[model samples]
Target: MRGLLFSSSKASSPSNSSTQSPARTPVSTPHHRTFSASIQEEDLLYAEQVIRRWDLDSPFYTKLDSLFTGDRREARQFVKSVKNLQSAMHFFVSESASSEKLIHAQKLMQVAIKRLEKEFYQILSANRDVLDSESVSNRSSRARSSVSNSDSDEDDRISTWGTSVSDGERATVSEMVMADLKSIADCMISSGYGKECARVYKILRKSIVDETIYNLGVKKYSLNQINKMDWETIEPKIKTWLHAEKIAVKSLFSGERILCDYVFSSSEKIRESCFSEICKERAVTLFEFPELVAKSKKSMERMFRSLDMYTAILEHWPEIEMIFSFKSTTAVCKQAVASYVKLGDAVRAMLTGFESTMQKETLKTPVHGGGIHPLTRYVMNYLVFLSGYSEAVSDILADGPLQVHSPLPESYFSSMTSDDSSSISGRFAWLVLVLLCKIDAGAELYKDVAQSHLFLVNNLNYVVSKVRNSKLRLLIGEDWVAKHEQKVKQYCWGKLSFKFNEAYRKHSTWIISDRKLRDEIKISLSRKISPAYRTLYERYRGYFQGVDSVVRYAPDDLGNYLSDLFHDAGASGSTHSSSSSRYLSRGR
Candidate 1:
């Protein structure tokens, strides 16, 4: 009766329609004519036959129902059957069929399945907690069983649920995830969260297997495609894609965290091997996650800090080499270097020492006095010099220069002319000039510049005080003390020396508050530059007047000082814009 109900309805619907709407004017015209509901009934009858033939009360149907209800046991079975169905669909989804009608039918089937999946997910979500707990318990139990029954076929059966999905189904799943990611990406773009969306995209990218999808999205549709997507229609799919991404990322972090804890907590070679393996795994596809690199670096730092609690690990493992290879390590090193360069001498020294200690250095060299880590130092200097050049050039280009001042002094005054002067002798004259020019050249020269500068000053003051204090100890006959009287005289005679607190305190006051000092500084710097700069209009002289095969400004050695200077300037900063600004300045 259920399958044949349409046979009786077809003969009865037309007569009832005409009589039922008597209050309305019925037209005999074809457009207004009523049709029998029998065709609709027949169509429903046909669909019910396929559905009922599958037997909704069967064990398979009950399992599917439980799957939709979030039972892990049932879900596993459901997935196996779904995988079989997907293999069957591959002839439709992935391969061209012989008949167009069959192709259309296949598409209808796919749509129906997707709709079913949507309904299933909705039911699962409504009972998410129950499903989540079941999934965790099931997963844990499976993991234990896998270890216990390594050779058993049951383990294979369980593993095959996700891993045994047909290639076609896996591809289809990837396609589905990609499609959903695209929708979420579009939503993100339209909602004015493009940057955050990009971050999320980076995190989700490696989860999807098809690189071709990303390539197509980026190259063909571009970011504009996101705005054109139907988010309301695709939102559930997006959530599924996001869920997959979360699962993948969480898995990666779990492995990373476990290894990190083991490597840091124990000195055992096996544990270190495990940790190294984990780090390598994280790095294997790291390029796909550019946005997560920043956060990962922070996480690694915390991880490394925990390692201190286990000193035996430090003694046994080559952690320095291992850590540096981590993406997080490089990022942290970059941040630390920036902080170090701008920090006060004391803090900078401390940080520098820490950095050096972390290194697996083969050679020993002094790192103080701007010579710390020749490669790093060179990078810093080049960047700073380039910045100064940029500032000088910008000033030159800004306006008509009617007046100019003298070059910077060859020798800066270490002592004040007046005894009561309240300034610091060490104004970081060269460094300050370099920094000012860098700032004027439109570079964010220092992130925490002021604080770092002050710290350096305090550190220098501390060192100088320590030296003075040691001098006082000489009066008490300490063997460690050098000849105090001669040392005092020599330091006093030195033009770089200050009259203790009097000279520096005065200079510090003036340098801190006086605008004229900056102007004077600018003037002094301009004047002290090479004489060639002042003679820009007239340069007719040749240096080979005596018939020697020589060049002007050429040194006996081959290296160009100016070129080296510029090269060093470029090394100070990583960003191209910042490096470019460095070369436009002259004095600094």
Candidate 2:
């Protein structure tokens, strides 16, 4: 009968005996019979009473678990229950319970706690979707509000949101999760499960941070899209939006370094948008200057104003670069340089066109009374005006470091010491040189050598005088004016030596037997050549005295002949002869 009962007891035991045994025992051990024999019925009853007590408390633990896992509830109840359960287990272990009973009760509590920890993690994982959805919905609502509101309303809304977020008037899903996790962690810490608590909190914190960064990225992308739109129509709106975002972010995260990065990135995008539009407008205006300048003086002024606007925009590049920590200052400066170069090209084209027009006019005008044509005066005046502003123009054009430094030849202009040919000052100097060369070339088109020399003298004198009288003297220098003045003197000398002296040599011996005919012929010759001869005599009076002895006319009577040089060719023959005789007696 005893063997049968023992066999029955073994049969009733669990098939997986290892799982049913204590955690410290091995599955292959043959101590089951001895272990069963050691447990008294009184110890079994006590173990049963402990387990019954736990079962009775299951409803409370289940309710606490539900409350802790529920959204929008404080975790105080769950924390208190965990503390109570740990206390109860300690109390039960300290009572007069047998060893087996105490061990069994400890194992039961440990199992319950482990299950609760597993449920806690599962709840955290399950709530992730809710947290994500809440974050997405909040972002969407803010975006919608921003889009629908006017500027004033938008400002107010942003201010309100910033205040609410700062003051914690509105709680995010992450905040709620963190609050619950902190409670759970505290309970676990008290129960000596600190490592598990740390692991859960680390994961939750990482997820919250990642979600925040993603949301911020989405907001930044939206602003970028708005920034890239048409600048003229949307620039104000974009600026206002950026300002609001800056305020919002600053208020929301006042001490966070991340806010600085976000603001800088958004500002960079705004600056890029403005820069791109400015560049495009500058290019279009530069290419269109030829037509615009032809329309009116106001059109040219407008073009310059546009250039100033582009320069103003470019000036902001340094501030933008510094704020954003950008590495593209060189590239931005290149854009500024390109715009100035285009401006230089436009000015060059206009000057070339003006030169062409002046050349045609100069070829038709005679160089007797005033020498220079009206067109020549206009061109010289314009060049002087341009040179006066050369310094200002150079400042506008030269924003970057000098790149080219080839030495200019000595013959070009020794006073111009700057070797940076890429600079605006260098370019302006080249333009002035080009215009001067054009004027010199135009002088060669005259039919007579004397007239050509006279033309050069008049133009060069005008340029030198204007430069001396204006700010251009500072740019071109006194030496440049002196050099051109020397050229004018050389031209005057050439006209005298070639035109006046040669004419005198050809007509020196024109004598007629008839006194009336002789006087008439001499009077005619005097009218044709006296002005140049008198000019030469006045210029080289004492120096050419020995040479003048070989000439037909005596020095005493030269001024009398010179005074009748411009008499009309169709004047009465008697009147011309009388006028010459009257000037000759006055000369004596």
For lDDT, the strongest prediction is 2
Model 2, clash count?
0
Q: RMSD in angstroms, all models?
A: 27.8, 20.3
TM-score per candidate, chains pooled:
0.21, 0.34
lDDT of each: 0.30, 0.45
Q: Give the count of colliding residue pairs in each prediction.
A: 39, 0
* Candidate 1 to truth, TM: 0.21
Candidate 2: which stretches are off by over 4 Å?
Answer: 1-375, 400-409, 418-425, 521-557, 560-588
lDDT tens digits, residues 256-301, model 1? 3332232122123333433334333333222222122212222212
> Which residue pairs in candidate 2 collide?
none
lDDT of 2 by residue, 1-588 (tens): 122224434544576454565886545444763454344333444434443433425554443334344332223423444455555444334333345644664565454456446545654565554334334234433333333333233222211111123223334543343334434444454565555544553355345434443444322223344334543534343334334323322322221112112111223433233223222222222223222222223223233333333343344444323322323223433444454455444444444445455434434445564366565576667766665555545654454323332344457656776554555545544545655665677676777776777677777667667767887777666777677666655565545444644553354333344556656766776666666566655764443334333333444455444433333444443354465555334422
Deviating ranges (above 4 Å) for candidate 1: 1-66, 70-101, 119-252, 255-348, 351-588
